[model samples]
Target: MKTRIKFSKEGNLRFVGHLDMMRYFQKANRRAELPVAYSEGFHPHQIMSFAAPLGMGLEGKAEYFDLRITEEGAATLHSAEAAERLNREMAEGIRILSFLRLPDDSPNCMSIVHAADYEILFRAVAPEDKIAGQFVDGSAYRSLTGDEERSLRAAVDELLQRKEIPVQKTGKKGNLRELDLRPMIHALRCEDNRLRCTVAQGSEANLKPELLLSALFSLDTARPFAAMPRRVVRTELYDSAGKTLESYGTIF
Candidate 1:
């Protein structure tokens, strides 16, 4: 039986790298005594594959991984039971939100993930640094006291109106290349020091929240983005056509 595990990562565990998290779950599965399938080799490893890996220091509510178990194991280890057992074995920062049994012919989660939603909570800039008089909608400005929020909202609106926003990102091989982020950003909103955005993810194209912030604020020239985004949480995942895949709130 093939199954997909939806989980969440928060707290100090956000600092854990993808490889470390993978290892942590491997150990958790062993300690939980799950009947996980193994590869046939001198150094056997569990047959499991994770979806898009979360960046270090970023939290995710919809992380996923697929694993295989024998039919007998499936009967004994139901989805809810599996989640319960794993929760007991998992550390404080990680939680198994749900376990969904997939059809034998279903594609792996990693191949299907084409986009993801993220919510970033940031600290508002001080009044002295506000771009208050910039936006087109100035009628509602006097009533608002948070200069940072207004400035950020205006910036987001401007970014959304652009034809193309090019951003430079360092690739895995250490080469930096310029890529247009406008097409990658499917949806974006900034309000009250929080940014709710959805961008392309997975093997083909991925856009990190920090990259978007860097583009919006010009982190290189303007003040660094050190004060904002106190927390970032990935809220959901989707396929190419915007079809909702397994989510954190999903129940088996």
Candidate 2:
């Protein structure tokens, strides 16, 4: 039997890397005594796989992982009770949101992740600093003209209109590959201090949202962009059709 685990990472746990998180769960499941299946070998490891690895400093709202379980009365272990058992053993920043029993034919979580929604919160930059700074250094932040605000809104539209936005993508072997980032950015929006965006993610094609954001920041030709995002929070994961991956499974 296979089980899908949905959880969230925040606070200090956001600093934990992917490999460490996997090890944490290994020890966690062992302590919980969940019947997680292990591969047959002298150094057998738990049969677990993650949907997508969250970046070190980012927070994940809905993250998923898959694990196989012993079929001995697996039905009884497929519900909130199982999640509760794991939760008791979890540290403060990680919470097990759901324990789903996927359909027998369903693919693993990693292969099915095609898109992700995210919210990027940026630090405040003074309005005068936003204005090329030469003519506006003495101005107050709130006193900016309507034209200045309108330009801020138009910057996002102009970025998406570019024919090609090239970025250097590093390969696993440390090779550099120049790739166009336009098509992978499915959606982008800039509010006062936040950006809500959706971008491609999968083996077929992947574009980190930060790349798209960097391109957007570059649109401000007059002023040097003063701040990077203060925080990035992954809101959800989806399939190619933009359907939430969790929607494809059944509650255990």
Candidate 3:
């Protein structure tokens, strides 16, 4: 049986890296004596996979994972009662929101996840006293200048229509790869010192939330700043059809 678990990370736990979190969950399953199936190999391991790994220093309300169990009864271990038992043993800043059964044919959360929505908070700039103020001012200016706003919108639209938007993927060679960011960008809105956007999913065209924000910032050349203090909170995850993928409300 396959079980999907939704959870949140908060407090100091937001600093924990992906691999460490995986280890933490593995230990939790062991302590609970879950009849989780192990891979058939020399070095067998629990069959578990996260929907998406959270970036360091960012807090979010939604996160999820899918786990395969050897015995059907082990699926019952994800119940609310079992979740509470697991939470009691889990360290502070980590909370299990819910666990539910999924259809055997259901796509893996990681592969089916097509878009992620996030809200980022940053420092205010220009004449605005608050970050929100800057966002409002920028919006007003854009609205007042019809031609400029139209041109900017057109450029973004054209970019979205492309088959691929090449970006540098940092790896052993620091090579350039053609990733279609168009499918990844569902929407982008700015308010005050916060920028909210949704980008497409899948490993092939995944866009870092920060990279999207950087592109938006570069759109305006007149406003110059060395850096910005930004914090991101993932709001939701969606599929290609724009359906909510899973609830990770407790993770943030």
Q: What's the count of clashing pairs in each model shown? A: 1, 0, 14
Measured against the true structure, the TM-scores of the candidates, in listed sequence, are 0.85, 0.84, 0.73
Judged by TM-score, which candidate is best? 1
Q: Mind sharing the TM-score for model 3?
A: 0.73
Tens-place lDDT per residue, model 1, 79-186, is 788899999998776889888888767888889989999987643345553332321112111122365556667777888899999977888899998999999899
* lDDT against the true structure, each candidate: 0.77, 0.77, 0.65
Q: Name every residue pair that clashes in candidate 2.
A: none
List ranges where model 1 is wrong by over 4 Å. Answer: 123-145, 219-226, 247-252
**Higher-TM-score candidate among 2 and 3?**
2
User: For residues 52-75, what per-residue lDDT tens digits would candidate 2 score against the true structure?
Assistant: 998887888899999888888485
Consecutive 10-residue window with the lowest summed lDDT within model 3: 135-144
Question: Who is ahead in TM-score, 1 or 2?
Answer: 1
> What are the per-model C-alpha RMSD values against the true structure?
7.0, 6.6, 6.7
Measured by C-alpha RMSD in angstroms, how accurate is candidate 2? Answer: 6.6
lDDT of 2 at 45: 93
